[model samples]
Target: MNGRRTIGFLLLIGLVLWGCSGVHPTSNAVWIAQPEFSEVDNRLYSARIAPQKGESPYFSFFLLTLTNKSSVDLVVDWNASQYLFNGKPQGVMVFEGIDPEAVKNAMVPLDTVAPGASFSLEIMPMRLIAWSPIKEKTAAARSISPGMLPIGENGILLALRHGNGHITIPLSVRISREGLP
Candidate 1:
């Protein structure tokens, strides 16, 4: 049953990955990321990607505005890649844990962003995911557990401290055709 489920999941991912082909060639390769919040319903916060009007084949970063709806303070540990294709989450990329230097360089501290407070996280182009052909060993790993591998055409994952357990976020991703770029 577990094997079946895994196969099913892989098939689903394949289908979504294949869906990219439906993307018209004339359709600008512009990225469209829409974040669907995981509803916990306790004074939830929100974030979104705002597409900028500009030239083609250009990288526009993920512009997120986090809104604090609850009265109490919500502490969001900063170590997750919140990228997804369309509304379906691609799965979280778990890094080697949060490094202060990485956070200092790549992320901005919320510093206890109070309730009803709003803060934005802007990920620039250079920081975004870049894709190239997978190496033989990495490709083999991807064939097994793409999630377990450190890097691939699928991009990077980050591990976040969630109580005792951890959550993963894909920091950067490159979805492409099976054979073509």
Candidate 2:
């Protein structure tokens, strides 16, 4: 009985530790691109790109900060915005809206930026997930060869639509393994 009790205790402890070791996705990834600030229509816009924590290597997050300098509310259509990665256009994924709690503070609501206020927009790339064997085969057939992109030397472009016009910001990211730029 004593030996059985000790074994059960050790098993419980192991299970607890294993559960704790599971990765909980966070937004604390290394910023590959420094924040780039731009001023348009008296409003300030800043953008940056970073790899999301606990996600695939290709998965990234584009963060946008918009500050309303004008005395009037600024309307932004985040859903209609576009992102270009190294000249390749990418579609925005709607995962955040599907599971808001999973993303935590990383999820940003699309709404009006009140006068003298600011708002953030987080964007993720669309990824195709195969659910069935046939779908898996189809996806594999259509998938392009996986390759490593030199993110350090690539350029990222973000086009965000505002009330009247759109703001285009180009981010030139230079990264080094030794340190961040």
Candidate 3:
């Protein structure tokens, strides 16, 4: 009986530890359902953005997938990419040398997406001073500048120039103390 109790206690402790690891086993990671798609110059472009695993409040990272559904190839200029917060443009943050392997793999080489193919990339926007819902509510109380508040109902806009046209996708991200989903 004592041995069985010990085993049960150990199993309970193991379960607790797994839950605290942040990486939920059951796909608990938040994700966006409907990706934004637009047609420009007879080419279809779709984009999906989501928070990186174990995202931080100080600096948030996002995973992006750009798909090309048209018969023609498309090129994306990463240098010209912009992130708009609440209809206002914010500074773009470059990962530089600290980029992880997964992030590197996600980066589009030459910013090109072949016909009927897709490119995965990682984008880190400017420093988000108030990402958590609780922090958002207490931002004024904490004296954080209003401009630094996280993008809310206005939604985040990702604009990328492709060839002679441009593709703008609006992403509605829900951020909480836990993380963006």
- Per-model TM-score versus the true fold: 0.35, 0.44, 0.47
- Write down the TM-score for model 1: 0.35
lDDT of 1 by residue, 63-164 (tens): 444566756564545444444443334543222222335544656342344778876653322224333234533523321111111122222232333335
Q: Which segments of candidate 3 are over 4 A away from where they belong?
A: 1-43, 55-59, 96-110, 128-156, 178-181
* Candidate ordering by TM-score (highest first): 3, 2, 1
CA lDDT of each candidate? 0.40, 0.46, 0.51
**Could you give me the TM-score of model 3 versus the true structure?**
0.47
Among the numbered candidates, top lDDT falls to: 3
Per-residue lDDT for 65-114 in model 3, tens only?
77887767667654445555555665443332323333335453346788
Error of 2 at 116 (Å): 1.2
Considering every candidate listed, which one attains the maximal TM-score?
Answer: 3
- In the range 69-168, model 2's lDDT, one tens digit per residue, is 6666566544544445555545433333334332234343456777678776544444322223334445345222212223543334555555577766
Give the C-alpha miss distance for residue 22 in model 2, angstroms: 12
Clashing pairs in 2: none
